[model samples]
Target: MSSSKNTLLIILAFFSIYVIWGSTYLLNKIAVSELPPFMLASIRFITAGLLIFIIAKLMGKSLAITKRQLINTSIAGFLFLAFGNGIVVWALKYVDSGFAALEISAQPLVVLILMRVFQGKKIEMMSVLGVILGVIGIYLLVSQNEVVSKEGSILGMVMIFVCMVSWAAGSLFVGKADLPTNYFVNTGYQMLAGGLMLLVGSLLFSESWSSPNVWSEKVQWSMVLLVIFGSIVAFTSFNFLLKRVSPEKVATSTYVNPIIALGLGWYFLNEVITAQSIIAAVVLLTGVYFINTKKKLVIFSRFHK
Candidate 1:
């Protein structure tokens, strides 16, 4: 690829991840109102995964994977989608979509800590400051008496925190795991694996399944958008960027997603954006910026050395 083409592709990919993905918090929130969380997620991922395979096959890409790669993708699927994403969808029933997005914005902080805990990676000074600010930001977001006092809100917030952990763990795993070389094929496997597990979860929970014809118009639209743009387009862009750019730059989605989610939720869903939520967003994104900036510096030093 020429430099110009690469730059253009990078811009497009970043837009997909930043805007489309940011909008998915609201999209999932909309769909989950009329559909069960696990069921909603399963349908979205399964449809997207199958579509990916079809697209890949049409483009003459092989979908074959080693057994170990399949297993790794399956594990990532469970961590990133089944548990991490599904439970957040479940929590949308209780929390405002904007609030949920804001909470998830702290994922980089969690990933940072998880690296230290699981891999014995040294926490640098910048990251330590990030950890401190993340704690404060999280407290500001979750400590609202009115927010948590809502029915099931506490549980929702706690479960979202768990989802963050699962997502962060999945990130760590993907960094080191052996998987398909083709990002599209790799994403397809993970989505399929995650969707299947989500189906099992829905069955285990005895959640009612309804036909799309019975779903509300808004929900149907939300599901379509989630499956197409959110899952297939934006997620593939995510994997693409992960390979093409620095990790810190890819992590910039963390800074933009919540703002987009907050705006979309407040505008479309009439979700309240409390003053404290604004404070939390600032503190949280700043912390993430500190961490990402430090990361970029570290990578630059390594490359130059």
Candidate 2:
């Protein structure tokens, strides 16, 4: 592809991950209001996974895989989707979508810590400082009287934190695990496994299921959007961006997503954005930016591996 074409494709890919994924938070909140969280997640992932798997097969991608690959992929899927996504959906019942998004935004920071602890990666002072600031930001964001007004809110915040940890762990695991060679096929298997796990959880919990006749239009539309735009399009774009751009640059979506989620929540759901939350967002995103950016300062160079 020409340089101009490549740039345009990159822009489009960036837009897909940044906007579509951000919007999923709000849609998830809406979906969970009517459906059980695990069931909702299960449906979304299963539908998306089946569609993607079909498309990949049509494209001549092999669906065959080893037992070990299936096992590893299943484990990754459980961590990333069954817990990471399912719990966040449940938490949305007690927290604002924007607040959940903000809490989940700390995922990259968690990934950094995990890498340092498990992979023996060298951590720079600035990265450490950024992690500290991110923790402080999270503290400030959740410490507000309005935020913890309900007892469930505290639990909700805790669940969101767990979601971040799960997602980070899954991401780290995927880097080292044996899986399908085709990215789309691997992702499809992960989704299918995770979705099945979630469905079983839903059954164990005995979650109530409303009939389709009673399902609201908004809930139906939101679920459809999630399967199409959130899962399929955004995921494809994210993998595409990983191949085309620096991982750090692609990770910029993490910072941008919260801002988009906050705006959408405030506009559509009339979610309150307090002064404290704004300040916290600024502090948190600044810390994230510093962590992701490569510094040329001499002091920072000393920590490089």
Candidate 3:
């Protein structure tokens, strides 16, 4: 591809992931208002999975995979979607969407620590500083009067933290695991597996299955947006960027997503952005920037040497 086209595609992919995925936090908050979280997540992933699977097949992409690959993908799916996303959806019942986004912004810090502990990766000083700042930011965010006053909000924040850990672990696992060559096909399989797990959880929790008529128009529309823009467009773009750009560059979405989510939540849902939250967001995003960019700077220095 020409340089211009490559740049354009990168910009488009970045926008998709940054804007669409960020918006999903607020949309999910809206969706779980009426629907059970597990059921709603299950339906969203299953529907998107089946649709994407069919589309991939129609496009001549093979869905063939070894048993081991299937198992690994399923495990990743369970971790990333069932636990990570499903739990957040449940927590949204108690937490503000903007607050949840702020909490999730620490994912890079979690992944950084995990990589060092499990993989024995060398941590840069900047990354370490980033982690420290991120933790401080989170402490400030959760210590606010708003979060403490709300019943169960503390537990909800803790659950969101766990969600980030699960997502980070799943991301690391998928990076090393054997899976389908086609990104869309692989994503479909992952979604299907995750959706099944969510369905099982729904059953175990005995979530009420309300009729479609009972769902508000906003909830219904939010679900549609999540399935289409959040899952299909943003996810596909994310996978595309992973292949074309440096992973650190692609990870910049972490810094951008929270801001977008905060804005959307404030504008649409009247979610309050407290002074503490704003300070935390700034600190958290700065940490994320350092974590992602410091390694690239190191690499550039090495090349120059």
Best by TM-score: 1
Computed on alpha carbons, the lDDT of every model, listed in order, comes to: 0.86, 0.82, 0.83
Residue 268 error, candidate 2, Å: 0.7
lDDT of 2 by residue, 111-130 (tens): 77776787677667777888
Clashing pairs in 2: none
How far out, in Å, is residue 198 in model 2?
Answer: 0.4
Cα lDDT for residue 251, candidate 3: 56
Among all windows of 10 consecutive residues in model 1, the one with the lowest summed lDDT is 296-305
Return the TM-score for each candidate structure. Answer: 0.93, 0.89, 0.92
Superposed by TM-score, candidate 1 places the C-alpha of residue 286 at a distance from the truth, in angstroms, of 1.4
lDDT of 1 by residue, 109-218 (tens): 77767767777766678878987898899899999876988999999999999998898787767766788989899899989999999999999999999999999999
> How well does candidate 2 score on lDDT at residue 305?
19
In model 3, what lDDT does residue 171 have? 63
lDDT of 3 by residue, 89-196 (tens): 999999998898888888877876776788777778777888899999999998999887998898998899888889777766776678777778878888889999
Whole-model alpha-carbon lDDT for candidate 1: 0.86
